[model samples]
Target: MKILKNILKIFGILGILFFFWAAFVYFSFDKTEFLKTFQSRYSKVLYDRNGELLSVFLNQEDQWHIQAREIPQRLKIAVINYEDRNFYSHKGVDFLALLRALKNNIFLNQRTGASTISMQTIKLWDKKNRTYLNKLNEMIQSFALENHFTKEEILRLYLSNAPYGRNLVGFESAILFYFDKNPKNLTWAQAALLAVLPNQPGLIHLEKNKNLLLKKRDLLLKKLYDKKIIEKDIFELSLKEPLPHFKTHKNIAPHLALKLLSEDKKQVVSSIDKKLQIKFENKALEFAQGLKQKGIQNLAIILADTQTYKILAYVGSQDFYDLENLGQINGARAKRSEGSTLKPFLFALSIDEGLISPKSILLDVPTFFSNFNPQNANKKYYGLISAEEALQKSLNVPFVSLLQNYGYEKFFYKLKYFLDFKDEDYQKYGLSLILGTKELSLEDLTQLYLGLANYGQIADLSFLRDEPLKGLKTMFSKGSAYLTLQSMKNVQRFGLQNYDKTKIVSWKTGTSYGRKDALALGATPRYTLGVWVGNFNAQANANLYGVSIAGDLFFELLSLLDRLDLEFQMPQDLFNIKLDLMSKYRYDERLGGAYTYTLYPKEAKILRTSPFLKRIYEFQGKEVDSKDENFKDAKIQIKLDLPLNALDFLHQENLNFKSEKNIKILYPKQNLNILLARDFDKQKALVVKIANLKNEKVFWYLNQKLIYEGEATSRILDLKPKIYSLFIISESGESDEVRFEVKQ
Candidate 1:
């Protein structure tokens, strides 16, 4: 008896010492370091401007934990009431509750849990076996947690780490998975449902055990009402609420959401207008479905604000899940050939250079420059057309002629230096560039159009809020951009005719070669939109072209936009002048028949001469020899009477003149080479001309063969493919010769 008493005393003293050591270690543990060493998985979230959830990127652990502040008051009350009624009052372990549980399990043969919220939080952190030793360790850790963190902080850690069935952890993830809503927005019934879920999470299937879940939830609600934590009315209403059904989360703006999520960011706030994006996405899908019936498989649309240059709505593909169409590819960012859509820029540049006015006439007849020959879209020529009319009609020949006159080098330089088109080498794109041979993305094209709408200022587009605005680059003079927009506004098409006439949209359409791509770009003073319809595989669809397909969709989108004032304000430095319709030449009505009003920048230098007289002056200056017989009677005559000031401006510029002698090559230029394909000869013919003197005879020869002798000034020659020497001899013995080659 004495030895047993001594052993008991020694054991009691050792237990007290061990308790003190554990207490010291618990108090000394760093709570922050504990949290840092613990790794809990969480999903990244994407939100739109309205704070609406766009998408959630699931982590490997399938958890979507939120911050503690995101926890709701109702949820906290429900969880505390169900899990531990005295959670706030307990110090790590509730001694009274433990005694009651021990009495029930040992003496009454009934089982009950007495683990406080802090003990459960420690258990979650350790994730160890539920043995007595582990429980003791948890008790020590729980005491440390209670000492270091506030009651609310301990509850937050417990809520964030608790498991809630179906491989989901954390209150946010479980609530979203089961109820499809945030915890803070949960109702009393929802809070009750979540409160009992963690108890038997793995064993209770929502569908199979829904009744069980409802029963447990009701009991928890009763407990809350009995304890006066919830009012009788609220408790009754929560019991009446139906069980929550599992709802799949909606992944809106999936492409953009995934793109932003890929940047490894925890949260992303985009500038997208959710309503507009949804509307445009539906429209794009419907349009693409309709086109698919006609063998077209893909489409994209982008709408941006001209003032801020921020993308408001973007549909990167018609259906991102359509594997057959390769729909995962973002068509808006893909590069493709740009057809006649770029013609307006070319005309704008020419206007800025003071090379041509809107009324300047361009030859639309069959013509060739070097080895290249261009044709109009309709395969028929209008002989001669004004620059403005050609652009409105989208005439190919007129634009090609203008590009030739403007020079390819200058246009290439402007596109590279001014705009940031750095993808293609300059040499790869040729004279066919005016016809849309150069490749460009829809984003690039939209930016260019936005520049035109913003009075020739180009700025980079933004996709996020509070992003720094890009520096503005000048693309065209204000006057030139205005003129281009004016021309585009008058474009004749089915889409434009159907829209509200009061709202002006300066727009252009492009159809790439073989109809592989269809594009339409439109801009108002407030907004800019661009759309493309094509196959991602670069397959051609004959029925799909810009005017009938892309243009129609563009107009439909325009109708959905809110009305804004689109009136253009003319700059103070621009002036209007009258021009002859037939000749496209500036004429004073005081000395002329009829004319149309045309706008020109005040700084622009206009040529003061008739088109006919200008042509004759150029011929005389270049081809007429002073010692030749044709020069003896070559005297310039002023035919039209003019105003004194106009005459003075003309005389100062040395442009008011009409030459009597017209000695020049009208067809083949000096040292020119021509390719003679089988089809080329049918579309084009060679003609030769010499100045006609009074009863003077002219002789023409090809390769020393006297082809004709005529008194007429012009003669058409039927020459075959060969190197030929053509000689023209006047009756006065003045001779000129040209050597040229034609190849098959």
Candidate 2:
């Protein structure tokens, strides 16, 4: 009995020790699996919205290793069947298979692998030489891994970490490298081929030993057929499919692909439309070629969905491979001079502030704003221009005046809310901010216009198709945005041909000072596009006019997008209002001017009357009105009948004088002596001419007396020989005077 008790005590001790050893092994896994570390080096890949591959960027290791988000069932099954048939049934280490392998090595004198999928996954982690100690360690970790993860996960880990030849790790990399296809679209033969590659990766080469690889793949397929995993017909057809040939990877949207590449992301399904990207890339190339002859060297374009704020197509440069022109520089993101692209925003703010309506008459004549003089592009101004026409014409004076009246600091602060201004110093830009003193990227300009298309709401553009939008904010009132877009619809187009005018396209063009940059931003109901054309070196070109070059490309791509037929829905917050033609206030017959219709903001108070009453000058039964009532008496009248080029001067003279907006008196220079022929039957009248008129009506006064008031930049004055001072005053109260003596 004592001996029996001794045996029971020894057995109890052994049993307890064994239980603890098993427990130790079960919890000994590294928790963070080896595949996680290996998968971290996956190549960053970009795919279009439709799952088309756009571009691929190699990982830091310079290897093709792309992790599969979801393993294909066929690939999973094929891998398991080929690598470890008992993968699902065994805990981790298949003891029966291990015993068979041991028996084969000892008795049959042949080496065999009995490592299950879990054991193989562990073996891949260390990549150590096969030895008894390493095998034991793998077996221990394999069993622990089974406890840590599901069987499917262990299978996935094996497929992801295993080498599939050609320095490519993971089934995804192999599928993409070998077949140039996504894993989900793999055929049975392709799956079987990839399945057996990891088994003896060193021996199977895609370029060599094709027959051996084929035999192994065929055997796997036969096994799958025998197990009834695939139908007989599929099995036979899969056998006929030839081995995949290595293909050169074609990169589409290379610039955007490089931009979106991140070290942490394995694969990114972007919002880009592959077809649209290719189409625009070609179109941009064509356009860039057309401009290259004119010394213009680069172009960029961006397109996005207005509602979703997802980037649809991005052409960062005309030719990404054109090294001579620095085509690799992504112009879409580079900050260039912003020009008049921001004018719409200023007009929108003006409408929101009730300072002006779309049809409100604004003085476009030359004016000074605290020593800063801004002139129109044509160097001439319209005396009376509607706000919409000013924006359409991209007149600098009107916009600068609007900024001055709107308050410089107010517009500066408001612009910050909509865009990220690189230079935060508001005082540096001042009133020039409305005229593009701020530099912006094509992306920045596009986002601003996209806000207008979205009815005053703005959101950051999204690249990832599945990424949720997070930064949407309101930038303008619905009424103001709608009215702003309405005014932009009829702006002149540069290169548009056979356009369908019924389709409303609201767009604006910009030309940076010095003509170094040309830009266009436009939006339809469905799409928003921004185009930039210029030299990367900032070299000014005569052809780099916003309305001509960039505007042409913008309309071309806009048509290519097939979105021209769509129109924005007018906001209900806008209503039609009648304003007097001259006063731009509530129309009344007493105002004595024709009335016109214009959309007005509902939130703004109605404009009742003209701020300044008009002054009428009546002479010779003809009347002309002046904003200033300090005009000379009508009884001292001079009949004002002026025609173009109808006067001859006694002598031609040149003058140099300082004046606002560079207005100059062309004929009768600064104090000069003029001699007329006394013997002539019909004496030539002393003629006065002016320069830089810009369609503005200038008052011709001889010695402080109004002589002519008509629509002529230069008036023909029929004057007798006399010493006289010629004073020309623009309707905006800017004046230039010169004196000359005419003697016979």
Candidate 3:
């Protein structure tokens, strides 16, 4: 018995000596360094499937921070009453509580602890194992800290800095998140909530144990009353407070906050409303599943607030988690061919280069570019058209010609200026840019689209909270984006605006080969979503155009959000420019070019209504000679003869129709005839139709007061026996009627 007592007394002395040594050591060092050291050991970032941020992943176990002040009086009373009744009166050691714990363990044969809040905090920081020495060291460290910090300071730091589940590590963050406000603002009910988390924050769900929270809160309140911290009335009043009345942590900005909130060691607490993430994520998954079944192997989408650009949801793929190869290749901004969707950029570029204005004339005729001659779908030339008209039709001939004229290098440089890309950005995505030949990820398109939506600003996207991205160059003039937006709203004019029947949705479709397709990284006043639908296996579907797939998908999905209420915001000088507009009628008098070829409107003009038809000529009357007889079918012949050189000149200059006065009149052949209204008014045009002798309708031209009906007998004017059928019409269906004079 004496030996055992001697061993026990020696053990007690050693413990005391060890505690004193630990206290001395802790008092000599800085706490900030200690905190930093703890962080270096553990920190990991979390992200949503769409490459969006979720939060940081930290802690081997769950813990949470709550301000000392935020902890309810009843909560504080409950913890101290159940765990250590002398908590307020003790230094870090809590001698009385330790004695009681020792008696309980010795008598009851169970493990018991008597560490004060200060000692608890000290143990949390210590990485050493939970040996007797480690516990002594924690007690010593707590004692030393007591000299530097007050009881409240120790409590504040302890509550302000504790691991709360994965990544959450500070009281300020926890209180704001849990109570949805500052720690000082936590109500009595909210304060009780914090205590429930310390046992195992993640495992604890207050909602699942409403009775437990109430019971704990009541016990704590009763203890506080017994300890004299609060009166009986106050304790009862606090008990009456609700369980979830304090703020909550439902992370609303799930996607945006994911990127913004994940960072180095520190806690990120913001107004992130993650309450709708489940619904949003589910919807996104549904879209991906639908696309996958249709062989649309890959896709990316982003949902954002229209006014503030705050991202609501981001569904970048059918299943990013399932595919190891997806989203791994594309950076935050995706890269891909823009297809015809890039036309707007070129149109704005042209306006800046002074190559052509909106009203500039463009002959939308069949044009060739190297070996690649492009044509419109309808395959008919619109004789002369304006730049706007060409854009409206998405006419390839004009765009190809315009790009060639603008100088590919110069245009590339211009694009570089707006894109302001790095060498790697270009290397990974080069020549294919202009032709949309290169592949782009969905994010890249979304960023570019952001430039369009933000009125020429390229927002610097980042994934770190408190590290705001800065210093971005302007991609384009506000006027340019504004102009593009306004012009694009006219998709209806081009007959392709059946996209969103519900709202004013402005979008563009890009189809480059079968493997590439896009339905804009576009925005209205409410939301912006960019979608890409294509075979991930590099198989292009000839039948699936960009307009039909991704475009359709985007419209269908966006319609579910709500109607996009937006208007066409036009520029100040919209379509106000002096350009060489095209004219179908040419005026060159010497070559039968009329000084004024009156094309009287169907409606009468007030100034002059007498002459309904006017045909100007370079030669007539006295000029007529031996050329009159050959007039075909007893009809009048109007012709002007010119030198062969002049004919070649007209052909070279593309002035064949310009010199109307010089074209020779032709006569109908074989069974052809004429019905001249000679006594009819010369001021009016007579509708004329002709036919072969078999009575089948044939070619005819309208002439002044001359009408020819099929199968009609030749009708002569007031002139004396005029020879008809003078112009030879061969039996082979070819006719030669040239150089006949007009006798006036």
Q: State every prediction's TM-score relative to the real structure.
A: 0.74, 0.79, 0.60
Winning candidate number (TM-score): 2
Residue 301 of model 3 has an lDDT of 61
Model 1 C-alpha RMSD to native: 7.8
Candidate 1: where is the Cα deviation over 4 Å?
Answer: 1-40, 61-164, 167-185, 222-234, 356-363, 405-407, 417-424, 495-503, 564-744
| Candidate 1 lDDT for residue 449 | 90
**Sort order, TM-score high to low:** 2, 1, 3
Q: Pick the candidate with the highest lDDT.
A: 2
What's the lDDT for all of these models?
Answer: 0.75, 0.79, 0.51
lDDT of 1: 0.75
lDDT of 2 by residue, 606-688 (tens): 64554423434665554544543543544332221211111111011122221224345666767777775543545545545
- lDDT string for model 1 (1-744, tens) is 999999999998998998897887687678776775343355666667766566776666555553233568999999998999899888899989889998999999998888999999888777898787788788888888898999988898888778777666778767777887656689888888888888878766576687888899999999988989889899888899998666777566677776676534656777778888888888887888789899999988889888888888878899777778887798888898778899999988877666678887766655555546677767776655778999988888778777877787678777777557665566566678888887888888888898888878888877776677785888777777888888898887764565777667888999998999999997887889999989889999898788889998888888778864576566665788777655656764544555677787665456343443231211355445466667665654224433222233333345453334323333464577876444454532456544443335778877899888877656766667777788877777766677877765
What is candidate 2's TM-score against the reference?
Answer: 0.79
- State the lDDT at 567 in candidate 1: 60
Clashing pairs in 1: none
Better of 2 and 3 by lDDT: 2
